[model samples]
Target chain A: MNHLLEVNNLEINFKTYGGEVKAVRDVSFHVDKGEVVAIVGESGSGKSVTVQSIMGLIPTPPGVIKGGSIKFQGKELLRASKREMRKVKGSKIGMIFQDPMTSLNPTMIVGKQIAEGLITHQKLSKQEAKKKAIEMIKQVGIPNPEERYNQFPHEFSGGMRQRVMIAIALACNPELLIADEPTTALDVTIQAQVLELMKKLQKDTQTAIILITHDLGVVAETAQRVMVMYGGIMVESATVFDLFENPKHPYTWGLLNSIPNLEGTEKKQLIPIEGSPPDLFSPPKGCPFAPRCKYAMDICLEEMPGDYQIDESHSARCWLNDSRAPKVEMPFTLEKEKTVTVGGESID
Target chain B: MTKNLVEVQSLKKYFKIKSDVTVKSVDDISFYIRKGETFGLVGESGSGKSTLGKTLVGIQAASDGDIIYNGQNIKQLNKEMKRNVNKEMQIIFQDPHASLNPRMRVGDIIAEGIDAYKLFSGKDRTNRIYELLERVGLSPQHAKRYPHEFSGGQRQRIGIARALAVEPKFIVADEPISALDVSIQAQVINLLEDLKVSEDLTYLFIAHDLGMVKHISDRIGVMYLGKMMELSNSDDMFTNPLHPYTQALLSAIPKTNPRDAKRERIVLAGDPPSPTNPPSGCRFRTRCPHAMEVCALQEPQWKEVEKEHWTACHLY
Candidate 1:
């Protein structure tokens, strides 16, 4: 399948007052046309930075994309000139940011914000954009679209503001959308509604999605393919089922175990991985996860592991998956993943 | 009943937007937390989950309710009584970064609560502070450092340590782990659990993350637009969600397992209605997937839908 957007060997760094922070390092992934791809990791795992780089939204004064290519529809976005890239930004690739409150202009009426994007990208007339903006408000399921059009961003709820943001992004009907933890700030029920709306819109627009979120549960629901990041490195990449059912990376296993599961609610105590992410200012010499990984080998501490192929589609960067190393038991959830399937279909 | 540690009865916290209209933030919601049990309050952003927690802890005075802690109404607490009660009922704020005093040393911040209750002398307080620091898995030496010195998880631990300094019998942990990294959230939660066991403390653990909240809470209360929509044991709430909202919330929780096909997701029509200008009666009626005319006009009476399981939806 031809990819709508492809990121190859992406590297990003932030010039902090203290020093340079290597936020994203040598990461690569692709989103097929109309496909929903999830970039999953804990905070500081460079998930957000990777997607932000794709849109050229990362500020250069501090955030600098040092290397790699971001190609959208075979167009080299990373190397594209400022004037040339501006044409593609909203018209071809729209972005819905993480926090709607901060993302939307506070003073401007929500409808006008949507209108501005359409006018800027498509050169829609004010009259045409106004009618189109109201139509968009309806499309995203906002109640009283006319009244809402006159109200500021603050007038809308957290979820509604997000909808308005989505409406703005989709008003131009961009071929691709980059949502960076779009619903993380929302409540669970509201998050569900927004996510459902996004998925539904994807069905209609067929816009390829780069959904960035740390929450594993959201990843499971939304993504067809999953890219797991740890300490600026893409540790694993696979289909959601393959990654969950047969996790090979020790970091991924730790992540699975750490999640508070409904099935395991009976257990009184939860097993928590001790320690923290290595400081980006000065990362460790080898595998970033080795310090906390229970299955960490001596070699893991000394050198980075090569990507180990689990299947044709699934690959994990872990020493434990090295055939030379001894095998380890799977996390309790993955053990269940071996059998569980949607629609009650048995898979082994 | 072994004398419930905290009893909230008919809690009606309504904000008077104007002379005529009122936003019912926590209307007629009631629950009790017994000694040494974790009771989780679960809901979305506008669900009044946080308001209910704040009311129980007296962070905000209830509009029309009784927060009876050990036979004393928290709303009626005098200056001295309020000061005394403050020790046994501390709140863990949602944003650890915003909650802590940036200018002051962390040691001073923790000790401020201790000094308020006057649990120990100057020397004893210093020693107690160090012990509390280590209890939350922070270095005792970190006491000298400012709030910015520690990571997000560590800063939250400082907040937890401050809450413990007063040696509170009950704590209202208001989304304590939401702002943390997934890698560090478990550690903080486990620390809270450990402290709960050691201190024999009751907790009103409020969060949007049902999965994380379920792990610690024995019984869970589901709130929506300032009302207790559903209340049940952790097992029952997950296994047999009564209210439509609860069912929707459960289905929404992203499970990592791939073979599990997404359930028929209850996509509520619109966002949660605003509290200030809430819909006529049943607040959830606007976005409720199974809403009816009766739901629009009449507020659903809270009742025991099943044995030990409570729900406030007409559909039940």
Candidate 2:
């Protein structure tokens, strides 16, 4: 796999009334060509901020990327000029936001809006852009594409509006797609359809996708690799199989345990992480998650743990991963075992 | 004789658009909730789940049918009886940011119901407010702070505290945790469960997420555009769904386990038909992969396929 995009030592801060909010702190990751990597995190985990920085779309004054190197196709993005960034924004790297209603122009016709990208990026004529716009709409699985093309954003439903947004993003055939919680607003069925559409599009176009979402289910289904973020940093990174089967970080375990299973099994108690996310204004001196982490040691409070390698592709940032720390079992797995043993005894 | 906490018979809520057109938000839906049980309502956007919730809480008046609350038809109740019924039924809205009053302190917002009924006076009311705040996992000092001072999850807890202040027997949690983060979502769900037991509360938990619904609900109801598609116990619904729509919905829930990555997914085609001009007969027929000719020609009857398991489909 060839590297398509690489973000190294990324740091972002938002100047708030309270203080300087360290939104994204020393985050690093990379996406390979034709590969899907999911950045999984809660609201303030900096997953969205990292992606926004990559797109050079983060607002200034209030928002600032303190230090980072974002390289796309061997070209540095942080140092890129405004004109250069604009040319690369939609044409080279397409983005789909969570709310399609806000992203789309309320007054503009859907087709004309899509055609604008093609006209600017591909240098297509008015007639060509219109024709391509209709074709793109049809490709995204919107029924009666011609009719939908002329309708306004308000005319479409939530799911249909999302498809329109997808059509616009994929119009110029960008090599990379950065989808920020694209299907969060849609229902489960519609989300399934949109995800399926994205997988199919990737197969045909060979576009590398960086899917940023808090949904582990989405990550398991669509992404090959996963990066679990906490306190504005990547706590754990691994292949989908490894992450689910042999998760290392305590935060990852908490996330997996918090979600209710949908396999028609008896409901198990969800082990929610205690306390809320750390305040970004003055982040913890050591580990950001130490306050909520059950396995916190004395060192965990005073010093941060670096990424300890588990294998060639899997790594986690936790004191438990350190050789000096005592071995500890994952909480959910232990709870499951206890239940299983009790059930076995009851059967006897 | 079995007593139902709340019962609905052929409920309909229609919104008029201009002079001719009308949006059939909730059209001819009937169901009942047993005491101390969470009834889950799941659907896509514009499926009328919120409309059903609003109508039940009397925020939106039903255009037709009856709402029997504690053995009295709510629509037919006198002004005095209606005021009394309001004390038993309350709602926790989806957006806590918008639901809570910006001008009032947390204490006043939670005491609004108490004050309306003159349930308590000056010092006693303050004591009750502080107790309610602590019950929902908030600090007693939080009562003095405004809504803006609280986080999204904290604000939702305040919403719960306000609902509990009146000692409501039934609460409508209309996507209460959807706006929260995933980790915070679990906390809210657990808090709701804890309160349900301590307060002896019955909830109409309306949300689109199937996993979260199954966790908190004893029974689940799936709705399509302005119509109920399926209803059954939560376990039975997931294990053996009869309706095609229900099965598709269950299948669409992305499995968290990576080993289940190869799980067969049923991706429904096209968006749900508009409620204003829903398809003739079954509303789900337009998007149903198993759609037959009769599905378009005639509406399916709501049938009890098995004991306490109901579905609306021609195949069943």
Q: Best candidate, TM-score-wise?
A: 2
Q: What would the per-residue lDDT of candidate 1 be over residues A19-110, giving only the tens digit for each residue? A: 99999988887888888888889889999888877777889889888999988888898888899889988888889888999988898888
DockQ in order: 0.66, 0.70
lDDT by residue (tens digit), candidate 2, B127-224: 99999998998888998899998899999999999999999999999999999988899999999998999999999999988899999999999988
Best by lDDT: 2
DockQ of 2: 0.70
lDDT: worst 10-residue window of model 2 chain A: A339-348
Docking class of 1: medium
CA lDDT for candidate 1: 0.84
